[model samples]
Target: MSQNDGTGQKPQPGKKAPSGKTLARRQARTLAMQALYSWHMAGQSLNEIEAQFRVDNDFAAVDGAYFHEILHGVPRQKTEIDGAFESLLDRPLEEIDPVELSILRLSTYELKNRIDIPYRVVINEGIELAKVFGATDGHKFVNGVLDKLAPRLRADEVRANKR
Candidate 1:
């Protein structure tokens, strides 16, 4: 059986250790998901949710600025983000799990607004977030939705990567 490192990361023989910047971004995503879930489920204001995250979570190590952007940006663009997922999804966004919806919104935000980041990277991050925080089978759903979204959002990059 494969062993997990103390941090719950499995040792993959060929996988390189994530760089410091990458780890910080991952943590930022994690925090952003939590903040969004709160907003989606409780109907909290964006400023309130962000302020709560700053007080409740340890932010000294994460990308605080990135977290700020995601937490605010997703809600600021919620109508557009949810509308994008709405077209891709079989049901309304209100039917989605708050956790999964939060992750999706973040991925949607990255795909539409942050083209500097690769589409594959956004999907991988969304899948990871869903696996850790969403329902048991949520990662598969996340994978499916994001897989469909990637080509539409990043056609050139997807076609390039296919080769």
Candidate 2:
């Protein structure tokens, strides 16, 4: 029996279902994390890494613009993004797992620059990324760090949410 896809048609062989905006954004973040991890490990140029990722991945259902934004944005603002959360870390930056570090940097960038996204969402996305890509219990670390960084980055939004 053929199953109906969400679009109400029989699933086509070899065809991927298009993602909703949220899922597309999530895919973007996931890909960005991987690209960031590669850049961190290899010390390669961000442009090269981004080009490689674009060629290697299936972006049909991904948010291409958001993916591009993060792949470039995090590195472009690395110093500020890291500074925003580095002091909150219990250990030295070098001690962080590469995956967790990548997630942290990406989410921190959104928190600081993407004011349209709520601080809670930035934190939640970080936690979710950590759960998916990080070591066991890494989600808690992500949660803690983002929770601390949120207020500093989104003072008015965080303040309004608390009230």
Candidate 3:
């Protein structure tokens, strides 16, 4: 029996499936994380490695340029993101799991760069990614950290938007 057809269950509607843009953003983040993971694993130069990822992953065709922008942008802004994180986290950033670290970096970058994105959505997406990619309890850690950090990271904008 097929997965969806045999359970006597109908697919839920109004669940708000991701738009093409959202899906592309998610794909871009996954690709960027994969690239960063590869770099960490192999210790490759940024230009050499990222170029290879572009070719191998067909990154040019992806829709969410913001994801790629943040992937590259975060490294440049690492000190700021880390400082913000350090101020908010209960423990040092170094103590966090590498997967969780990456999620936080990606989400923080978005929170900073994509002002149009709602802060809650950014936090929720980060928590969801943590659930999938992090160790047990990682989602809680992510949610907690983002909850504290989002207000500071987005600051007056969040207050202005009332999100």
Candidate 4:
């Protein structure tokens, strides 16, 4: 039977069904992680890489606006994001796994800039990304890093949640 593709179209029978986590925002995060990882590994210019990603990826099921926001926003804030993660790191920044680093930086951005989003959600999403994209056992590291970061970045929210 056919499944609903992310873009609101029905998938062809026998085609692989999309995962349950096909919500547009989540898709945007997933894509952002990938694009950020690409930028890190390939050292491509953000504008060129973003343009290429837009041209190459199907955006039907993705939140195009959020995807745009993430890819562009993260690099602009790279110094602060890296500094945040670096403070929480047990090893040198360059030693991190690319996928985990991407997720951590994205999570850090959300924690620092998107105060409307709950810290728990940001940490949880980072964990999920690490689980999906990181090396085996990497999710634990992501969780630990962001768990520490959440309090530093969102002190009031973390304090309130503890109550």
**Residues 36-123, candidate 2, lDDT per residue (tens digit)?**
9998999999889888988999889788899889988998999999999999999999999999999999999899889987788778
CA lDDT scores, all candidates in order: 0.88, 0.87, 0.73, 0.86
Report the number of the highest-TM-score candidate: 1
Winning candidate number (lDDT): 1
Clashing pairs in 2: none
Q: In terms of TM-score, how similar is model 4 to the real structure? A: 0.84
| Candidates ranked by TM-score | 1, 2, 4, 3
Worst 10 residues of 4 by lDDT: 1-10
The true-versus-predicted C-alpha distance at residue 71 of model 1, in Å, is 0.7
Consecutive 10-residue window with the lowest summed lDDT within model 2: 3-12
Candidate 4 lDDT, 10-120, residue by residue in tens: 756776755644467778898889999999999998888878888998888787888888888899999989998797899999899889999998999889888877899
Better of 2 and 4 by TM-score: 2
What lDDT does candidate 4 reach at residue 66? 80
Stretches > 4 Å off in candidate 4: 1-22
Ranking by lDDT: 1, 2, 4, 3
lDDT of 1 by residue, 28-105 (tens): 999999988888889988888888888998887788999989998998898988777678886777788889988999
Candidate 2 residue runs with Cα over 4 Å from true position? 1-19
Please give the lDDT score at residue 158 for candidate 3: 66
Model 3 residue runs over 4 Å out of place are 1-13, 39-43, 58-61, 160-163
